[model samples]
Target: MGTVVDAPAVVTEKEVVAENMLGDKKVTVVFVLGGPGSGKGTQCSNIVEHFGFTHLSAGDLLRAEIKSGSENGTMIENMIKEGKIVPSEVTIKLLQQAMIKNENDKFLIDGFPRNEENRAAFENTKISPAFVLFFNCSEEEMERRLLGRNEGRVDDNIETIRKRFKVFVESSLPVIEYYDAKDKVKKIDAAKPIPEVFEDVKAIFAPYAKAT
Candidate 1:
């Protein structure tokens, strides 16, 4: 943690270009992170409805990229299958593209920058998150939710879910800690019922509310 990690020069140049492009639009990105079944998608939808913000799920975007058969699609697909984190460069590029394509200035980007590589590479983008919304829930509860969600997703099985949870604790927690160190994380107790949890979320996002 003490030593600095540098991204490749090419990554930096590309990210800087993206930074300059998004910078002109004055983008506001809020990173939404949590375990697989942590209700991040549900809450992000609520935020978008109540606030004038776009919701972009990193996983969804990657999936879409795969479906579209983009050049990086195969790599992303393989990584996802093995539960490996995709290169931060690819995810960041997708995020930048989404941000640029949307008309909304503020966006809630769900499920990204889940490791130190991501955290470090993101520095070059210069499109810093307004804050990170961290959802905290018990593994037991998350596991139950994942089993019952019936999404028919490949990773919804108990084996994958357990592995994902372990990976989250090992990798994602550090990203949360980094943001916490910077005082840029809003922790939400997601173990509660959906509406009740949103009530708390609404309070944190009150300032960003849009006129109804």
Candidate 2:
């Protein structure tokens, strides 16, 4: 846990690209990786407000697909209820669409690149994050949070939550290791209070926080 770093109201793509080169902006795109109840959603919101970045949640994208009554809606709903990763192509299409539609350069991508395939697909297509913010918490804490979340969604049930947590551990660990090897992974102790966890997150991005 650390203090929040106030940032500029807007960050441009050029600035994002310039950061790594200039050694000033610590991160360009920040991939927020964590389990279903690991506070990735909550932290992304705070980061967006304080740091002025676009927050894209992959779950929200799939939920939108289900809501849109698209051709794949039924299948997506089933897959999500089963706590399974959606097809990379479909998921990447949604992510790409969101990225293209957004004008913000600094992005907080939540719940994406769930597995090695998803990570590879993104690497082959989209601009990679300058760094990744990983919210690390124990499985017990995640289960407690998800059960208490009370979202009433099918995916919030205990069975699905447990499945999703297992999927995350098995599939997402490699992505974390990959970023860790590159010295681009910022570890946040997510077991702490939400504000406290975000404090660490804000500090990690402080160097890149544009001064107003």
Which candidate has the highest TM-score of all? Answer: 1
* TM-score of each prediction: 0.84, 0.76
Model 1, 117-200: lDDT tens digits are: 888988777778889999999999999999998767987999999999999999999999999999999999999999999999
Model 2 local distance difference test score: 0.79
- TM-score, model 2 to reference: 0.76
Query: Please, what is the whole-model Cα lDDT of each candidate in the order they appear?
Result: 0.88, 0.79
Candidate 1: lDDT over CA atoms? 0.88
Candidate 2 lDDT over residue span 13-122, tens digit each: 54555443212223256788987788888888888888888888887888898999988878888887898767888887786677666766577888777788888987
